[model samples]
Target: MRSRWGKARRVSTLEGPAFMNELQRAVASMGPRVLLFLTEEKTVNTVSELRASLPVSVLIRLPEHQRLMELMHKQGFQELAEAMAAPVPRTVRLQSSQDLPLVRGLNYPCVLKPSEKNYEYGARFKKAYKVGSAHEVDALYRKIEPVLADMVVQEWIEGADGDIYFCLQYIGGQGEVVSSFSGRKIRSWPPRIGGTASCTAAWEHAQELSDTTASFFRQVGFTGMGSMEYKRDARDGLFYMVEPTVGRTDFQEEVATVNGCNIPLAAYCHEMGQALPAMSPVSPQRVWRDEQADRWSREVSGEAVNAAALTGFPVVDAQWRWHDPLPWLDDISRRAADRIKSKFHK
Candidate 1:
């Protein structure tokens, strides 16, 4: 789709079957220079099928298929972290109701989340639940255990969203680091334990986190696109690995691009055997926010969100880009429709 800003954006609906069919057709007719971006887990299987059926390259940054599978499940991630000796939030995996009692001794104010975030399961409820007591945890487990086959109980990292840091990197076809960018979250929707709502591009804590991330990927022999999320424990001043997302572009990737590290384009170039241009040094601090989500978050949490805090820094809208406005428009339309339907039912 061509927007008024003169940029062509590729937009697709999340309907699996139709989406895959269209993607397969497009890949079949496209050349080697065309790169396929896999954004959601719903389409991972489709991408695998495309890999087998078409000669076109799909940008899955993992070093191997097994690594991708490992990162998809929460338990697998815990194991991976253990293997790498990387510090992570204290976590215990539960397979069945029988394993529920194991959490009795766990620290309170922990979180419960699905082991694997498949689209079908994610459509049902919140991404995670923060429980204060064992009773609350047990109750939540009983309610969700039947629907979600596997889950993890993680000790809550005591900190606000601003303590969260991300290191986004692109590993080339030859397994070389092409470029990297880092940022810190300023705020997030759903208050604590939520996806980033606003973040500022900065390299302040990038070195240590980036080194650890690169080491883990290199040890596992991973390639393509890699991003790792970490939270600095306010109590101890140490960063703990929260999760790693491989082979897909994240929502905040544009923040990296705007700050001089164009990861998506670098992945495309590496896949096509083209030499990547030298990356410019990390740009000055810039803020990126999803205004709609931020407003909603502030409303729900009653947290003060001051635009003046970002007055001196450059700001980028996460979704409503001048070049591509359709995504945000569509999101607003869908949210309005859902609200109207909910009111009618009530």
Candidate 2:
């Protein structure tokens, strides 16, 4: 397979043109069969360019909800939800800000999201914001006027905490789940009470989580590596199925691979209907820390690129990296400068 850069044009906090150029050089020399696209920092147009260059498989996280559903229809993803028998949040499409009050009767702490973003790629919501009256709802609408025009208001499940429990599966062309891994999220940064995790562990607990995820994949007949997330119900101890993240969990890929499960390479073989290696019995107890450590070295500091060579703790194969390093580095830098400021205060 030929390797071409995906999403090379868009610029972000990371993976800009300069970064994409670096990625292209690194992958070009390595000779990958496909480009594993990260849509957050790049555009879907980049994927189009790559597929033009080689036989490729591309999966992207959509930045809006409507786009996600549309892509689901195109990529056979919607069928999975239908098959899983999963109950989804009640969604009302908004033509403009006018639709807010009509939907607000459902009331207080509802989820506001774009009708689509290909799939959960860019679903944003102010979870737990109470709107006891229409007045509060209107306030929110006015506050969110800039982005709310294109978004929707949906019935929010009181139990949904967004501590997503993820099930990673290697699926065959026949839609059978060949192997799987379970993980639980602990903390997150965006501080969006229900945002992405700051840390997670490959721990196993609920079997229903696996069964539900498996059924969803079987229905879609997905023939590649995929992940599904569930929001845990703290009271009943069950998870509400959120969405199926098709093809690779940017960070979980490392967790699974390091814990003796190689979903990336395994999914490729499964897609071709080739014989797959047995799933290794990797202990779920394994813990992986991000390789980059931020501190005041008093020396010219830079983020570490090579996580593979970091010694001491058990590092999962190809899973550990400084994918999001700058923000953390900035915090450390500020704290270090504060220490200097303290001495001067004396």
Candidate 3:
């Protein structure tokens, strides 16, 4: 799909019965010069299947059936942060469902999220829940037993959407911070008490988060794409580290593509030791606004939206691509129509 700017070209979707088959097509579609890095909530045999297809890198957040939340605190990610003198949240790992009772003695309304390689979508499968009281925690654990063992309970910081931060990190071959971009999330859904962003803006803050994150990336000898998320405390005004994702943060590659810097393309070029193409720095304050007015209208009662927060900007909203949405809409619409038909027939 081509955007109005005509610079961004959407690729065809690849769905396959086998992970290797999918990888083959992905590599072919992208061409031999491109690099593909694979990361997934669950293991896809894509890495091993496409080992020879092209130069590919794979990072695993968690192994199959391994409790992901438990690995976060134990993994060297936080230790690497401390060694780099980065500010990270005070986290306590739970060994059992019984450990949740200890949180009551600590702080109220603590943030509870999986430390593993999980995202918003995975919450449904794990039945991820956040609560204020000890009772709620216990009840949630009881409701979703084995999965809670890997989760973490940390003190929650209060802040508006502006407090959330995501940085696209690129490390050079010699483990130097080549470039990084900071973006502020404007709005989100599951309403996670945050959902996804309705809009995001390029931003700047104290170098604390950046400096520390660079140090850790350098220490890890990381040579590819990573996104670091943080939340600034409303009370003390300190930025607490949330997660340093090893892979591409969702929407990041697309955002970079639209704005002019293509990290994936850069990564492929860099891996080949080729001089990267001259990249034009995107103007500060680039906006990514969701245009799903119909969805928003369902909540509000009119076509005109009262979204003063996201009014004027060069934005990419949740508008569908007519070129590719047909397959997806067909499946959904067919299911809905079948359900209606069955109800009427009965």
Best by TM-score: 1
Judge candidate 3 at residue 57 and give its lDDT: 41
In order of appearance, the predictions have TM-scores of 0.88, 0.59, 0.70
lDDT of 3 by residue, 138-170 (tens): 776665546435666666667865577766766
For model 2, the local distance difference test gives 0.49
User: lDDT per model, in order?
Assistant: 0.75, 0.49, 0.54
Count the clashes in each prediction: 4, 18, 9
Q: How many times do residue backbones clash in model 1?
A: 4
Local lDDT at 75 for model 2: 21
lDDT of 1 by residue, 1-346 (tens): 3246434435375435666666666666455555667677656645554455434444454456677778767788889888888898878888888888888888888988888775555777678889997788788888887688688999898988788899998877666777778888877777777788787776767788778888877777777777899889899989998888776778788877777778887777777778886666554556788887677777777767543264356677766776678877877788899999999999
Instruction: Please tell me which predicted candidate would have the highest lDDT against the true structure.
Output: 1
**lDDT-best of 2 and 3:** 3
Error of 3 at 191 (Å): 2.4
Error of 2 at 53 (Å): 5.8
Worst 10 residues of 1 by lDDT: 2-11
Please identify which of the two predictions, 1 or 2, would achieve the higher lDDT against the true structure.
1
RMSD of each: 3.0, 9.3, 6.2
Model 3 poorest 10 in a row by lDDT: 62-71
